[model samples]
Target: MKLSLVIPCYNESANLPLLLDRCMALDSGSDIEVILVDNGSTDKSLEVLSKLLPRYSNCRTVRVETNQGYGFGILSGLRAARGDIMGWTHADMQTDPQDARKGLELFDRHGDGIFVKGRRYGRPIMDVVFTVGMSAFETLLLARSMWDINAQPTMFSRRFFETWQSPPHDFSLDLYAYYQAKIHGLKVHRFPVRFGERAHGVSHWNVNWAAKWKFIRRTVDFSLQLKKSMMVVNI
Candidate 1:
C-alpha cells in the first residue's frame, strides 16, 4: 500500500533543505510520498520549495496561501494525499521525518485496523515532566490513556481517517486523532523515536511558561469540549 506523510512548514525556510534531505531517503521509493506543506509561511519557504521539490520525484508541495493553524495545514496536506495509508510529522526537524517509515511497517504487519504513533525519548527532564503532567491530565480527563500526545509520525489508514467527523484545526488535532483512535477501538501501536533539537527557528509556542500556558489553556478547553461531545455520543 502507498503511504503519504505530510510535513507542514510554517516559515521553516532554514529547515527546508535539511528536512528535504532526510525525506529524500524515504521518498525515493514510489510507495512512500512526502508532502511538504507550505503553511502560509511569510519567509522564503515557498521559493526554497519551488527550487528543491523538482529534484525529488517522490516528494511534492502543497501551498496554503494563508497561514491557518498547524492542523489546518496538516489537514490540507492530508486532503491532497494519494496514499492508502496516511499520517503527518513535524517540519521542525526535531523529529526525524524518516521515522514515518516505521509507522508504515506497523500498517504492513498489523493491517489497516490500527493507529500508530511515536513515543519520544531524549527530551530534557523538564520537558519530560511537562509531557507526563499533560499526559496524566488528558488521560484522566478524557478517560483515555493518551501519552506523548504531540509526538510525531502519527499514522493510520485512510479509512480510519475518513471516519473522523470534525477533527480540530490546531495543535489539539493531535489529541483529537489519538482520542478518536482510542474511542473507536483501533489497535494502538507505539514505537520509540528520538526527539532532538530544532535545526532552525524558535518554536511558535513552548518558548516559555506563558506560551506553554496558552497551549495548555487551549488544550484544556478543547479537551472539555471533546469530553462533552463524548458524553453526548454516549447518551
Candidate 2:
C-alpha cells in the first residue's frame, strides 16, 4: 500500500531542508510521497522548498496563502493526498521520520481497523506540563483513555478519514480525530517514539489556564457528539 506523509509547516524554512532529507532517507518502501503544506509562512520557506523539490523525487510542496491553523493545513494536505494510508508529522523534525516506518509496519499488519499513534519522549518541562494536563482533561471529558493525545507522528488509514468525515480546521482537531476513532471502535496502538528539541525555531504554546480550558471545552463537545453517534450506530 502507498503511504502519504503530511507535514504542516509555518515559518519553518530553517528546518525544512534537513527534515526533508531525513524523511527521504526513510525505508518505507518506494511507494511513499511526502506532502509539505506551507501555512502561509512569511519566511523563505517557499523559496527553499522550490529549490529542494527537484532534488527529492517523492516530495511535493503546497503553499497556503493564508494562515489556516495547524489542523487546517492537515485537512488541506489530506485532500491533496493520494495514498491508501495517510499520516502527519511536524516540520520541525522533532520526531524522527524513521519512526514513521515503524508506524507503517503496524499499519501493514493491523491497519484494517486500527490507528497507529506515536507516544512522545524528551519534551521540555513546559511541554511535559501541557501534555500531561491536556491528557488528564481529555480522559475525563471523553470518558476514555488516551496516552499522549498531542503526540506527533500519528498514522491512520485512508478509510478512517473517509468514514469519519473532515476534521476540524482548528487546534482541537487531534482531540476530535481520536474521539472519532474511539467511537467507531477502532483499535489505537500507541508506539513509543523519541522526541527532540527544535533545532532552529521555538514553540508557540504559552501553556496558560485559558489554553487548558479551551481544549477541555472542545474535547467535551467532540466526545458528546461521538457518543451520540456511536449509540445510534449500535441501535
Candidate 3:
C-alpha cells in the first residue's frame, strides 16, 4: 500500500539538511512519500527545504502560513497526503523517521484494521516516569488503556483517519488519535523505537518542569472533553 509520512518542521532549519538525508534513505522504494510540512517557521527552514526537498524524489511539502499548534501542522500535512496509509513523526529527529517503516510492516501483516504507534525506549528516567503517570491518568480518565500517548510514527489506514471528527489541534492530537483507535475497536500495535536527543533545536515543549506541567494541564482538559464526548455518544 502507498504510505505518506507527514513530518512537521517548525523552525527546524538547522536539522533540515540531515533530516532530508535520512528521509532520502526511506525513499529507496516507490511505495512511500514524505510530506514535510513547513509549519509557519520564522527561521530559514522554508528556504532550506525549498532548496533541498527536490533532491529527494519521494518528498514534498505543505506550507502553513502561520505557526499553529503541533497537531495543526500535522493535520495540514495529512490533508495533503496521497497515501492509502498515512501517519506522522517529528522533525526534531529524536526518533529515526525510518521507524515508520517498521510500522508499515505491521500494516502489511494485519491490513487496515490496525493502528500502529512507536513505543519509545532509551529516554531519560524522569521522562519515562512522566509518561507512565500520564498514561495511567489517561487510561482511567478515558476508560481505555492509553499507553505512550505521545509516541512517534503513529500510522493508520486512510479509513481510520477519515473517521476522525473534531480532532484536537494541539499536542493532544496524539491522545485523540490513540483514543479514537481504541474506541473504534481497531487492533492497536506498538513497536519499540529508541528515543534520543534532538539533532538541532530544542523542543517547543518538554524543556522543563513548568512546560511539562502546562502540557499536563492541557492534556487533562482534552481528556475530559474526550470523555464527555464518549458519554454523549453512548447516551
List the candidates' TM-scores in order.
0.98, 0.87, 0.98
lDDT of each: 0.93, 0.80, 0.93
Give the Cα error of residue 26 in candidate 1, in Å. Answer: 0.1
Candidate 3 lDDT by residue in tens digits, 1-235: 3999999989999999998899899976789999999999999988898898879999999999998899999999999989999999999999999999999999899998899999999999999999999999998998899998899989999999999998888999999999999999999999999999999879999999999999999999998998898899999
Write the number of the candidate with greater lDDT, choosing between 1 and 2: 1
- Looking at model 3, the pairs that clash are none
- Please rank every candidate by TM-score, starting with the best: 3, 1, 2
How big is the positional error of residue 47 in model 2, measured in Å on the Cα after superposition? 0.7
- Give one digit per residue, the lDDT tens place, for model 1 in 1-235: 3999999999999999999999999964589999999999999998999999898888899999998899999999999999999999999988999999889889889999999999999999989999999999999999889999999889999999999988889999999999999999999999999999999999988899889999999999999999999899899
Residue ranges of candidate 3 with Cα displaced over 4 Å: none
Candidate 1 lDDT score relative to the true structure = 0.93
lDDT of 1 at 173: 94
Lowest lDDT sum, 10 consecutive residues, model 1, at: 21-30
Runs of candidate 2 exceeding 4 Å displacement:
27-29, 206-235
RMSD, each candidate, Å? 0.9, 2.6, 0.8
